[model samples]
Target: MSDPTFSVRPLDEDTWPAFAQLVEANNGVWGGCWCMGFHVRLKGRTAAQNRAEKQERVREGRTHASLVLDGDQCLGWCQFGSPAELPEVKSRRLYEKGLTKLPEWRITCFFTGKGLRRRGVADAALGGALTEIAREGGGLVEGYPEETDDRAVSGSFLHTGPMAAFENHGFTRTRPISPHRWVVTRTVSPT
Candidate 1:
C-alpha cells in the first residue's frame, strides 16, 4: 500500500532544489548520471556538467518529471517527456526495429531515495506522472521496463523501473526489446 502522506508535484524551477537534493544524496545517481541519460548522452561530461545541464533544462521548461515528496523533501522522481525531449533509451537497436511510430510521451527513468525502496515511492511517482500527463493533454505513453520475474536484479540496475510497476499503472507490454527489458505502453486520456 502507498503512504497517504506522500504527495506528488511536477519537476520545475520550484522543485529543482528538492530534486537536486535527492540526486546529490545518491552520488549524482548511477555514478553521476543525474538522471540525464535519457535527455542527452553524457559522453565525457562530468557530474557537475550534467548537473548544470539538467538545471538549465529545468529552468527552460524543457524537462518533465513527477517528483514524489515527503513533506517538502523529494523522495524520488519519474522522468517523462516528449520523444524530442528524451531521445536516448536503452535497447535502441531492437526498440527501433519494432518501432512503427513514436509515442507522445516516454517514461524513461525512475529514482527512489536511499532506504526508501519497496516503500511505494516509485509507484507514487508513476501515478503522479500519469496524472501530470493527463493534465497536459494525454496521449500514448511508453516505457522501457525490466522483467524481474525469476531473477535477482539489483536495485541499482533497475533504473528504467520494473515491469510490474508499469503493469500496476495500466501499461501493457507491447513488445520485448531485450531479454529482460520490454516496451510497455498505455494511452492516458486527457483530464
Candidate 2:
C-alpha cells in the first residue's frame, strides 16, 4: 500500500468511474458515508438517500476532491469545498466561538481504501487538494485533523486525518474546536 508510484489527480466526471470503484471497495466510506456527511442536511434522510444526494452534487461539479490514484484506480481522496458548500462543522459552537474569519475553502474529510490505510494516501490526498485549490485561485484553506496519540481509536474516526499531515503541508493550528480536533489553515498560492 506504500507504493511510491501512485499519483494525485482532481476528481471530475471523467474520473468518476475510478472514484466509484474506490468508494465501492471501501463500502461507501465510513459505513456508506459516500463522503457526504459534511455537505448534506442530514436530518431524517437515510444513508442511501444521502449517498444519492452526494452523487448528484458530484455530477453537478458541486463536490470537489483530490484523489490519490494508482493508474486508473482511486486509492484515496481528500474532500474539499467552500465554507458555504460544507457548513457542517464538527464542533459548530466551538468553531463559531473561536472564529476569527471564515476560510475560502475547507478540507473536510479523507478516505483511503482498506488495505491502503497508513500508506501516505491521506497525505497525498491533502496535498492534491491544496494543489487544486491553488490552481483555482488560491485562498485560505482550512483543515480539521485529530490531535491524538491513542491508537485505540479506530482509524475510521480519523476521516479528518491526523494533525501531522496538516502540519507537513504548512497548515498552522489556529484553534482547538474540540479536545481532539483542531482547526488548522494555510494560504494557497493565489493567482
Output the number of the lDDT-best candidate: 1
> Tens digits of per-residue lDDT for model 1 on 40-101?
98899899999999999999999999999989999999999999999998889999999999
Stretches off by above 4 angstroms in model 2 are: none
Q: Evaluate model 1: give its TM-score.
A: 0.98
- lDDT digits (tens) for residues 105-153 of candidate 2: 9999988888877778988888889889988889999999998766566
lDDT agreement with native, every candidate? 0.94, 0.86
Candidate 2 global CA lDDT score = 0.86
Positional deviation of 107 in candidate 2, in angstroms?
A: 0.3
